[model samples]
Target: MSMTLRKRAVLAAGGLALVAALAWAFSPRPLAVQTAAVTRGLYEQAIEEDGRTRLRERWVLSAPVAGRLQRITLREGDAVAEGDTVAWLQPGAAPLLDARTERQNRAQREAAAAAVQRALATEAQARTAREQAELAERRSAQLAAQGFVSATQRDADRLNTHAARQGLEAASAAVRMAREDLVRAEAALAPPAAALPLSRAGGQAPLRLRAPHGGQVLAVPLTSETSVAAGTALLEIGDLRQLEVVAELLTADAVQARAGAPVQIDRWGGETPLRGRVRRVEPAGYTKVSALGVEEQRVKVLIDIDPDQPAAAALGDGWRVGLRILTLRQTDALQLPVAALFPRPDAPDPQGRAMAVYTVDAEGHARLRPVTLGGRNGQQAWLRDGLAAGATVIVYPPAGLTEGARVQARTP
Candidate 1:
């Protein structure tokens, strides 16, 4: 063989080798994947958050008026009934006017009364004048009709009658004004009503406070020497016998909580888990900034605890409670994880709602199949109307795999 011929043969062999290597790299091969058996299990698609336990209702009693606490029998933690005499208050009296002020006030009252009397007298005189004017007008009108007086005389008499009516109305209004002034002056001199027994401002004479509802007194801050002002919180009472848990949740999670939905309240640091139902999902969400500076809108969800349950007996106010809000529950239902679905490379076009899955065909070739899905939560998706159970489903597909590609499930 010649040297030139040998070099040409070596070049042709190298080019063919390069072409075969490129085709193998581009060709579809077996993809490594994890298989999930389509079996029935708990499916929850939800966002979990730390929930807090709060009292079902807290009632803080305040003083009705300012005064000295005359009598107090009940102590802290004592049960009180409605209209119970929790505290008796000798209310502080209004400041009395001095003798001179009283005398002046009295004088003003008397003047008002005299003015009223004068108005009455004036009103009586006006009524008499109206009667006289009416009689004169009638006489003039009769005379004018008989031709003894001019037609103008009748009009003048009518004008006088109208003037008399106006005068009567004015007199009546004057009498009313004088009477009102007299009443107002008398009321001003009257003493003030009793002050609130318990007040927010601590003073020598504390205001009297009592429980508004029939419950055990949880706290009574008012002491013998402690003073209080109006609307001051003196004590707190709640029906310890009847208690419920109130938990705050993210607004998104709250929407999943349906009314009358079952709640599994657990990790209450109690002996046993308590069962509850969704009583209410607060309609409003408050702006809350989390520790990570996450601006989140949160709402409160109330779970009515059956007090007879074990958790409720051990529960107290402000206990940390966990709530599992169930979105959907069905026995013997088919479901799959959403992560199992992979988009097909040869799929017609991309539409967001459509979910595509690459399933292993009997021929050992990868086939892309379109499957419809239903509601899904945190980890699982409901197999609403597609994908029969007892079939092998692929989960978490490997990269670089396309439809109808020759592949094998390494696990099977």
Candidate 2:
């Protein structure tokens, strides 16, 4: 009876050991994961883009009339005061005439001379008629005063005299016009030297172009002395103190930008970032080709540098800088690392898309929880719901992580 009982107990113990080993081998092990604590802090959503500084006001000096422009001595960055002479222009040389053209001019001069003579003859005839009418009018007035002639005859003579005076005035004006025409004809036949002398002393006075305002010379399109037409640009002037930054942002990002938004200017060869504010968001968007050869819609955002800041004085026009426009800001918010977020699978919420994270409980177990997110910056995301401060969330969760999975926190 003792041998049988000992054998049964030994077999049962061996069977129990086998079952325990099998369960130990098949059970799931804890997953190793990185974690970050959710905390309350200031949250800001910003759009980062490259920008360039430019002058607020630029004036382009142009040639007022066609002339020979003098050589400009002023170089770029040179300061000039208001009313300073920036350029000098001499009267352009007259066009040279060929043999045939000279002959034609001579013929025109002869024709003009003949026409002038005809006008003078007509004027002289009108003058003589006017003198005779004046004498008649005087005799009529004298006769009417003496009551020897009728009133009708005196009135008719007076009307004739008035008409004659008008004719004489017209004739005088014609004579003057004739003389002017003759002078113009003679000028056409004269040599170019008579009109515009080659020597500076005898030539017309040179024209002077002065600066309209005090500023630095930005550019000079004309390199050397040359003849320029009217409205040709000569130089550019602008004050460097009034500088504004322009950032080209994607259309999607620009839509979120608003006037008075805070901005940070960086990477402008300065030790500290400069502060600025959004002045404008351009109304229109333009098509641009990206470095990846993709077509994108882009818009411009203008930022005004804080004039009182020390950095403003250090910046100049056309300086390249980096701009971070704060589109959204919250003084107090619950935030978590952006890397911890993952898109929910299967059926999403009513919003059509949902996000979640693997949250670590007090017992060190990973649990999936859907989170309602607000604004998101580059490093952190604001949590509107489904999370609280002091909670731990797994970052870059493993592919096999599931709800209620055991996890071990990784060393920082």
Candidate 3:
């Protein structure tokens, strides 16, 4: 009986030992996660966009008259002085006339010549009438002085003389106009004069296109000798020293941009980024097709490079660069990595969304804490409430993490 009792006690001990071993094998372990510390520092919220440099003022030179343009010897990058001639344009040759057109011009000239002769004859007749009326008036004046002519007769003669003088003046004017017509008719009948070089074209000089201001020649669109009409673009000129940056931003983001805001310029193949300021946010928006095949409204934002910066002197017009426009900034603010924050479930705020983060305690346990966010840059988020400087928070928390869950911090 004593041996059977001892065996039962041993069996009971073995069963208890097996149960403890199974419990130990299936026990839960702490979840490992990355963590970061909250800190206080200067924070800036900025929007990044691509930008291009452009000349502030550019001038495009064009032909001033229809003429044969001389071959342009000036090349791009050539320095020009104000009022200096840049291009020469000789007078264009008259178009050749066909036999039919020549015959028509001859007929018109003959008609004009006949009209002038008729006017001359009319002028001669008017002169004779005026002479006859003047002689009659003189005779009537002498008779009236001697009482040989009645008062009514003398008045009639005097009116006739006055009318004759007016007729003579009108005829003289007609003769002058006829002479001008004859000159025009003779010119039309005459053959076109031979083409002359600009220097000796009847004392009239060739059209000289001069530079309106001092600048470097950017382009000469027409280089070969050819005929060009008036207002044809010939060259472009601009001062590279005065450069401004233009950035196209989405309409939604442009609304937050304001003039005089700070800008950081980068990616211009320079070691240090340049500084600039927002000069203007254009009121108009334009349609642009994005890389994703989506149409978007974009606005132009002009940025003026800081003249004091060394990169300003190195940069030239039409250079591509990157721009970071600071929309908001806060100094001495509580901020943390944006990765640490996540959307909170069933905790929607007035703004339609709420954020929460996992805060690690001294015992390496993660506790869910709701946070009010103020603003965010791409990498950092400003904390408005529910978080303080020096607090540790889990970054990119793992799935299935819960309140008061055991956690192990991963070292960077």
Candidate 4:
């Protein structure tokens, strides 16, 4: 009877051990997860965009009048001073006149020459009349002093002298006008090979196109001598010291980025990032096709580079740059790594602020916690509520991990 009881107990012990082994093999294991602790710190929201350097003011020098432009001696990047002579222009040759036009011009010239002669003759007569009036005035004054003429007569003589002098001056002015008319008529008849005199070319020796202001030449449209019409662009000039950054931002982001906000300039092929400030947010928006072929409305935001920063000294116009416009910031806020949060299964808020994270409970179980998100940057998220400081949350929960499931810290 004792042997039978011992055998039965041994058999039952072996069966219990086998059943325990099977149960252990089939049981759910604690999930390994990466975790992070929520902390209170400075949080910022910034919009990053590509930008390019551009001059705040660009000046285009153009031909002032229709003429034959001389060869431009200055090359691009040449420094120029205000009022520096950049090029010389000669008045364009007169167009070939038809037979009737040539005859008319010849007749006009002859008429002008005759008018000049008549004006000169009239001037000489007026001069003679003035001399006679002056002599009569002197004689009349002497007569009046000698009691031989009336005072009223002497006054009339003085008035006559003044009128004669005025007539002489008018005749002289007429002669000058007649000469100018004759010069114009001659210019109309001048041939292409004929060189114009100084009087015909506005009384200046040569027409000099001068720089409007001090700047570096950015472009030269006409390097060699050629005939150009009035208002043809000759050179483009701008000061490098006035460089600014222009960033094309989405309309939605532009509205939020106000003027006067601080900006950080990066990726400008420099050793350090540069500083800048928003100068303007252009009111107009333009449509642009994105790289993915999506039409997007974009606005230009002008940034004034801080001239005091030496890092931007070498930057030139049209250089590519990266811009980070700081829109919002909070000094003391609860923040977490963006990786720690995941999309919530619940209906999202209007701003899509609904998000959740799996916080590790004291019992080593993942507890789903819903969080109201505030601001977010590239790598961090600001939480408005639902999570306390120092709370441990899963950074990236494994697939199939459910609420209240046991979790273990992932081995480094």
Candidate 5:
């Protein structure tokens, strides 16, 4: 073939390759376009969530002694304080309780007190005998040396002293044991604010559930006159003066939790959102199955509401609210929505700590921009380096677009 003809054929082939590349780059694809604006604003990186409201300090009211729901003077939502009598229960009718059981508890307490007294008396007697035995031992030793007492008698005296010492020790141990028993008996008689329900299915039978602490009545489990089982729930108690926001976060989210993380809460039927701070993140995790039935670990995070805010008063215990925890925040930063950002897969590693994202130059080309991302929130991220303010970036660019691919900016 002639040299001129060979050159012309090569050029034609190159032209076709370029045209194909352009067609592929120009194809349509769903993409989100956003602008990088220069503004002085606070960028908060918070964990967004929806959760229920609750009193910061609330207690359940339960029966201290077994009894039926004889009468409940306070209704649900009634305000209560310490030492206030909320309910009057019948003499008998608690789940796991009978008249005999009530009498048994009372008898047990009196018996415990009597046993404690006996232990003290026995201890005192043992101490007195020990002192006498010790004196006898000294006297017997002197008499033996002077030949006034026989060796056998001296040995008998020593043995008596030893026996008295053992008796004293045993009496002391008994006294200690009796006191401990009394403590246990008292605790057994006392009822927890939220007692483990008498029955998981039924609930704690009417022993008037009392308010564990000063708080509001949240629920009346037994309002109607119906025969309840051993573990039937009677009522619920809580204090709304103190409130906290609780969120059920997945295990992954909880692992990243910190003590001072900021949070935002949105109450149900509320117009405005409120801010909060993370007070605690539970150490333990719970089993939760995702919609796909995949087993997952979940955790509870408690956020404390700021009292300075006006919305705090409107909140109550067990009320529902939405939360946004501020995991990170940046002031005066180059922020960009994740949708408008791109990661260059084939970019070479520069120095330490460098990420790549796509930017649209005035020429309408996908410019590979190396950026340093500092912090991020739910949607937008803080760009610390490699990106300038007011730079337009291609979100989902056209297919086959390269570092220098031609892209036409859709009119805003």
Candidate 6:
């Protein structure tokens, strides 16, 4: 009776051990995942873009008149002072007239002569009328004194005399204008050689073109002597000291940038980041085609580098740089890795704030935590709610990971 009871007990024990071993082997083990801890730290929202350095002001020197410009010896970046003779210009001679043009000029001169004669005749008529008016006014004065005429009539005569004197003065002005016109017409008949001496010394003299500003020559479009038309751009000058940075940012990003915002200038072949401030966000936006063949709206932002900084002296116009404009920043912010967050499209919150992250619970299980997202950058995000500092979150949660899923922190 004792042996049978003991065997039955041993068999039952063995069966129970087998069942436990199978369950341990078949049961899902904890899923290994990378995790990050939510921590309180400094957070910044910034916009980064490529930019170029440029002079704040550029002056393009152009020919003031159509002339032969002298060869410009000054090279780019050459220092120029105010009132320095930068170039010389010889006035271009009048074009040679063809036979038909010569005849036309002669006819025009004759016409001008005739106009002068006509103006003189008109002046003579006006003078005669003025003399008559003055004589009549003298008589009217005498008559008024003798009481032969009413006072009103004498006053009217006096006014007429004054008007006649004005008319005579106008006629004299017309005569002077006619004489000037005749002289100009006669001068036109002179040969080009006669007009070569434009100076008071009766010698051919070239006009000196002086620089209006003190700066370096930025560019010289033409180095050799050549004839240029008026208003043709010849050279460019700009002060390197007056320099600014220009960056084209996405329109959305540009709107967030405020004037006088801090900027970090880097990747400009410099060892340290240069300090700069946003001078302006241009009001206009332009369409730009990106490398991916996408159309994007971009706005230009001008940044002013602190001239007092020694690094700024090394920069020149049109130098490429990397710019990061700090648009927003917060201190002691509760933040976590951005990779920890994911969109919950299947069950979006009513407020449309459906961002969630997998956080490790006290039981070492991944628990889906709905978080109120705030400012975020490429690497990290500031959470407004649903997570506390020191809470561990699963970074880059796998697709198969779900709520209440068992998880274990992966060793580095």
lDDT of each: 0.67, 0.82, 0.82, 0.84, 0.66, 0.82
Worst 10 residues of 5 by lDDT: 30-39
Estimate, for each residue in 123-214, the C-alpha lDDT of model 3 and write its tens digit. 89999999999999999999999999987577666656755665665566566556555554564455445333335537435666777556
Model 4: what TM-score? 0.71
lDDT for model 6, on a 0 to 1 scale?
Answer: 0.82
Local accuracy of candidate 1 as per-residue lDDT tens digits, 1-412: 6999999999999999999999999986666666665656655554345566665456666654344554345577687864455665555554578989888878988999999999999999989989988998989978877889876456556555655665675676567657756764674477653222234564325433344457677776675744455356666776665555677788877888876666778887876767766768889899989989999888888766654455476666676777777777766667777787754445544443357666676776666667665556666766655467765667786776667776666666
Q: Write the per-residue lDDT of candidate 2 for residues 1-412, one digit (tens) a residue.
A: 8999999999999999999999998998778899999999899889999999998667777775468999999989899986789999786665678999889878977887887788888888988998999999899889889998887577556555655665665565555556655665675566766753355567667777777557799999997999998669999987676678999999999988887677999999989999877878999999999999999999999987766577677777898999999888888899999999888785476652368999999898999899888867789989899988999999999998889989998877
Clashes of each: 20, 0, 0, 0, 27, 0
CA displacement after TM-score superposition, residue 331 of candidate 5 (Å): 1.3
TM-score versus the correct structure, for each prediction: 0.56, 0.68, 0.69, 0.71, 0.58, 0.70
Q: Rank order by TM-score, top first?
A: 4, 6, 3, 2, 5, 1
- How well does candidate 6 score on lDDT at residue 268? 94
Top candidate on lDDT is 4
Evaluation by lDDT, superior candidate among 4 and 5: 4
Over 27-48, each residue of candidate 4 has an lDDT whose tens digit, in order, gives 9999988989999999989999
- Candidate 6 regions with alpha-carbon error over 4 angstroms: 1-20, 94-202, 345-354
Candidate number of the best TM-score: 4
CA displacement after TM-score superposition, residue 54 of candidate 6 (Å): 2.0
Report the candidate with higher lDDT, 4 versus 6: 4
Better of 3 and 5 by lDDT: 3
| Cα RMSD for predicted model 1 | 24.8
Task: Write model 5 residue lDDT over 1-412, tens digit each, in one string.
Answer: 6999999999999999999999889986533344444333578766666788765443444444444556455687787765566665443432454678767877887899899999999999999999999999999999889999987567556656765775686677567657755754664565553332354545554333333345677887666544444334566665454567788898777766686565777755567877666778989888988889998888989876655577577776667777777666667777777665555566644432355667777765667787776766657767787867787776655556577666666667
